[model samples]
Target: MTQAQTLDHTSDQSIEHRIGTAVNQNAAHTREGLLERLFGWFFKGLVYAQIWEDPVADMNALQITEQDDLVCIASGGCNVMSYLMAQPASITAVDLSPAHVALNKLKVAAPRYLDQNAFYDLFGHANKDSNIRALDQHVLPHLDQITRAYWNKATWRGQRKQMFARGLYRHGLLGQFLKFAHALCWAGGVKFDKLLTAQSLDDQNAFFDQEIAPLYDSRFVRFLANRRASLFGLGIPPAQYDKLAADTGGDIIAVLRERTRKLFCDFPIHDNYFAWQAANRGYKSDGTGPVPPYLEAQNFETLRACVDRVEVLNQSVTEMLAAQPEGSKSVYVLLDAQDWMNDDQLNDLWHQITRTARPGARVLFRTGGLTDILPGRVEGAILNHWRYDAEASTRATAEDRSAIYGAVHMYRYEGA
Candidate 1:
């Protein structure tokens, strides 16, 4: 079957089956190591409703234009919506997780139909009671049947719609992980919320120095940081775990401490939503806080106008690109998914990427390690077709406000 046909034929059962297949595929390529297996299992259960990477850095590196057709891995669906503001010709958002596919569809569809306040309440002020009601009245009727079914499915707490009522950010894998981190901080007498009170960069640095940095020194924190399972919260697969350790001289604690410090101290808290989410366990409750670019009121009308340009699919990126016509896409956002792949997988993906990309197409991605993996791993023949923009990549990495990833890499396809 054609790639689009295969994706279109994926019933809800098939999507679940695909998730299982993907987990197995990831595990099978990783030598079936115990930690790899554990990570694969963890990934299968993870529902990433919010993306962690900085989309602003991604867009800056991509230099997206109205003529560019883009394909991105839809994680939390945040960046997919954010990308709409750039007015790309088309955005094909593919994800193996059915939950993410549904969420992305919901995001794209919500803006098209819902009024401003209702849309904000559903996604921005996710803790509010009206979110579920808004989802029902304004959003559900507009979604495709599969997406609607996915959202309406029951969870342990209640229907998935109730997730917004309970606070959408508190439900996903990353969200729950942050919640656990906050719980740990509270137990240890460190108030993560206090980091939000810092009025300046120096104050933020001092807050981290006095309150957050010391938490990493505790035996309990050190022990947790050392465990592979502990990092599943951050969506670190077993392979990425090894890369992170190797990059940090096997000192995961030190690496995490440094990254956490950068997150808190390097950016102004007023505009760094990532730090706010990490510290406060959600976006600022007042709705005036820093948020994803799409959620900002200024971009709402533009995003709403561009909603129809996006397509959400439950499929793999390689498959989606393989199905496209040559020179079909100009921008690719891999979002650290490459770190999970073996060399063969990477080569296969790059092969399809090169085939589908137009000349001057820009590819943006992050890595668990500071070094470039593509140079040695992807076949030289395929790698030669793309020029790695090392200087731009370095600038993008340094400017990335999220400050969690080890490096951000960008490449420009030079054509056949």
Candidate 2:
């Protein structure tokens, strides 16, 4: 069966049905606005190519230990793999999107079965012709029936497995968006490649100031930045757009400029794969530069050994946590998923989180705006069970290499 057919066949399952209901509710909600409905539609079909939030900062916030059991929302599945580097006792990766669930399962399964070079070629190099062969011979045999069916189906570009050959970074919503951005940079006479050659922070800032900063000033670029739809490529829902605009005093252009500056100039390029991917459209080809924690050769064996500890599930975070035994999990990673939710949804989610959290359990998440949404949204009784770590959150937000989010929040459950 084709990709569409597979999706249709699976639409009635609990996870898919729940996600579909949420999408429809968001679209019908009067307060969500037209743009938000559009964003909902876009997100329902979107597959994130890479997770934008910095996992290094996340690790610092969560402070994962061997005794800890983690639950995180799996987006592109990169951070889940990176979290394996922490060697948590286990990780339950929950996502409403089947594509994300499939991707996470693939990541977990690939490292265990494939050899180093083959694994690297499939994900790190991401453009090898042998990737489909590797997937067939090594990866496919190990995937679950659902995940196997998802990847085996034919896509517009050929089989879904062919995405590895074209460069995995060039396939999804974010990937296609970045590709368009590169084309725009070329049209604007900005040499984005110069960023890859910079040896120092000074050189990085200088390059950005000379070649990159000017692109944002163009009328065409500024026009695009002002529109809510233009940001769907970056996984920014309409609610997130509103938060960002409110935070920036409604100057979207200035907000984009500042965020882009931080991405390009605020951090050392050698260690920031986020910057490397932005500039070159993939990771550093030589393998000496920055890559995701899981892709680093030193962590390969560790990830392989620990891969089995992760369980990828297609369900809402609230649903998953409600099904878990109370106090079963020690760490929670909610990656800006709350921005898409309403007050009731937030209350329901936090209720489950608070119930399932062990003593001193830490919940770390990012926000589109700097303001705390839970204070007024969640019930005071449920809210009182958690102590918000403002200082650590501020520090983590400052130290985050991604520089795309407005705030990183850390909450600790007090436990009865």
Candidate 3:
């Protein structure tokens, strides 16, 4: 290649790396920026083994049609894969985290390459002796080189994909954070077995009040919750952390306790895979509990047939949207990533969302606090093009089974 061509390629790579860095390192010399960097460092690798956002809530809000095209942040890839059951025209999944992008590719590729039982064993059962063979024989060869390298690369324990043979859901940064939370509970002279294993809603609530809720009031727990780094495992950056604390009158522990209560008592244990995952590390081994749509036995054929319509990318959402033609995308799933963006970043994102969005396109996102974030932050010109649906947003938020988020927002583009 010529010298100019090589320089141009190198510069483009540099720009790619810088895309999301500013969101985390905006206040680099300040204490807030330091916490951001710490969270960024911890978040550089695999964070969520499963996306926390509820795909059910997403599909409901999006109201996707076969003519619709989607762009979403592929955290655990669950949302993208599950959306296939709806049979959208295509999905363009992007993530700033390389680890998450790799995970997304592997997830969709496995369904295309592996049979029902093998795919279930690998992801549904999530810890099986046969997964290694399944990966080697069926899934690995079909994945992109980056995805193959990611799963096959050596980690301290072994190759990354071997996690499926062990407890795949119990190894990511979120998983380790959960492990730490459990340990903290043990140290605090309380255990969650009573709360998590309870058979009835009344029993769960009683256990939470009698044993779990009081644990948050302790000085040790309060001190840790106050630290911005403590909730990093939940992928809550320092910026979101501040917002959550502010919303709760500086009582992060109180807010956490409330969310935890909702996760346990709001839904029955047999029905909520999220609660099972939070308390038990993996889904119910007996296959009686619920799971993501893509992980369901009934949806297996649908996924196998439609997995090719999905594409995974390790790029910022704004950057990806900027490259798309105007009015091309119909649905946008921002997740809760906007909780980390500053005013400028939020403006940039809305600009692209408006540019790439069709007149009737829908945008859905979750927030750490109970408010639509775009109102005052995003510039008027860009934000004005979109119309917020308060009624639909409220109904969808209530329907959301995943109790982690404080609010869910939906908006429709009205065009210029």
Task: For each candidate, give its TM-score against the true structure.
Answer: 0.93, 0.94, 0.94
lDDT-superior candidate, 1 or 3: 3
Query: Model 3, residue 191: displacement in angstroms?
Result: 4.8
Candidate 2 at residue 51, lDDT? 86
- For model 3, the stretches where C-alpha displacement exceeds 4 angstroms are 1-16, 19-22, 188-197
Cα lDDT computed for each candidate against the true fold: 0.84, 0.85, 0.84
> What's the ranking of the predictions by lDDT, best on top?
2, 3, 1
* Model 2 Cα shift for residue 415 (angstroms): 1.6
> In model 3, what is the error at residue 406, expressed in angstroms?
1.1
* Cα lDDT tens digits for candidate 3, 70-102: 999999988999999899999999987778888
Superior candidate under TM-score, 2 versus 3: 2
Question: How many collisions per candidate?
Answer: 1, 0, 0
Clashing pairs in 1: 49-76
**Candidate 1 lDDT, 268-374, residue by residue in tens:** 99999989888876788989899999999989999999989999887989888888998889999999988888777788899999999988899999998898888
Give the Cα error of residue 298 in candidate 3, in Å.
0.9
Considering TM-score, which of the candidate structures 1 and 2 is the better prediction for this target? 2
Which candidate's TM-score is highest?
Answer: 2
